[model samples]
Target: MKTDVTPATVRDWFSEQPAGKLFTMPTISAIFGVAPGDERRRLAEAVRCGYLCGFLERTETASGRAYRVSGKGMRRPTLEEGDRARRKAEARLARDDRKRRARGAPVSPNKSSRVRAARVSLRAANMPVPATAVQHSVCETVEQFLARGGRVQRLTAHWEQMEQAA
Candidate 1:
């Protein structure tokens, strides 16, 4: 738990907790070795990313909320790690955009999914890429799309196309 403190590890830890164990914010934070405030955010992120369940274990507290692990096994990356990965990807995207601009090529803020798929395509095609290239993230692209007032109605093929476009 001390070393592999990733989302996956945390989910495992949550499962190892007693079946009906309820955690106060500070107690949970203590388990994670982070501040209660930070743990609150991390817990929310973990739940949002599907690593944990939506419902609280105890909802009748007057001071604050209490939580327990669902142990449902829907784990994903932790938000802090995701943020770091996102910043790294955006940096790479900005660098690529700069290069495109320097070459007098068309450059706009990129759609993250397309960029990711394009990178995958490049790898599959065995094309030579600049050594400085970095991986792109779908979340970054979606953020730009949202900033431009784009909306997703449903997750049909058309919506998927639009998501890639975004």
Candidate 2:
């Protein structure tokens, strides 16, 4: 902490806030010449409870409280800007799609496709591949499955597999 942050100093900072700008907790504390060290938490509590500071309210989509100095910060984008952003985003996505096609990588469409993609990444990294599928004893007794079945094991076999991998 630089110096003792009094309520009067905080009130002055709030009064100096710009009209249309918003600030977070750390930002406000930094404005007060406070270093973000051991004393930062103290500053946060002070700002949250500084009843004199105005417009220190929590935004709906925001995690912590945001200090809005303007009339409810609308953030409405211009029509031309919105259209430009959409076009740029779509063009970039299309370029990425072309590159994927050039590389011959399959598109992940479902859960099984996601599994296949994961296996491909692992193989690329030179990791061991896992079993594709394993059968389990669904209706047979443990003794029957152990003696009669070929290689079907219990579901707890995953733990054994994990230990062996480790």
Candidate 3:
């Protein structure tokens, strides 16, 4: 029971155990002779790896969440399967990034760089510059008014009467 337990080890161990036997984190930790603290992180990682590799199944029981041997097969994942999984994950991430970009979400990690890029794009497109302080203050005032349940109405013909009164 070395501190470094690989997913393969977990899978092999579960394969030897009786099928349909549920195991909780504490029970697994105890079996592995590891404390349910910082030392248990490696065990947790191994458990997660076993789960992702389809050798372990997670289920919700009356006691709590538990893990059991999948019993599907005791075979290890092939290198090609791992490569396909990695490629799928990468493609998913790339697709999500594209979707976020299409929704006008910031792609740059740096806040200042995002702002700079936005400003540059705006200038390139001949769009209006960012709002001034006065414009921002007016927007804040309108937001506050709306928050306070105030209603804004269209003046329509009443504009002439207001001008005459002024």
Would you estimate the TM-scores of all the predictions? Answer: 0.37, 0.32, 0.45
True-vs-predicted CA distance for residue 14, candidate 3, Å: 0.8
lDDT of 3 by residue, 1-166 (tens): 6545656677777888998999998788888788767668878888887787677899988877799998776356545768979998989988987888899996635577778889998888996669766543324577788899999885657778888889
What TM-score does candidate 3 reach?
0.45
As for TM-score, the candidate ahead, 1 or 2, is 1
lDDT of 1 by residue, 38-154 (tens): 555765565334423433244436657766766454434335878989998999999998898899987684588578878999898997656986787656577687899999666
Worst 10 residues of 3 by lDDT: 132-141
Which run of 10 residues does model 2 get worst, by summed lDDT?
70-79
Residues 1-166 of candidate 2: C-alpha lDDT, one tens digit per residue = 2666744455456657776566777677776677777567667665554533343444443656676543332234224768969998989988887788789985436687788889998888896668788786678776786798657644758879899899
State how far residue 72 of model 2 sits from its true place (Å).
14
Q: How many backbone clashes does every candidate have?
A: 0, 0, 0
Q: Could you arrange the candidates by lDDT from highest to lowest?
A: 3, 1, 2
Candidate 2's C-alpha runs over 4 A off are: 1-3, 51-55, 60-64, 69-166
Error in Å for residue 98 of model 1: 15
- Report the candidate with higher TM-score, 2 versus 3: 3
lDDT values for all models = 0.63, 0.63, 0.79
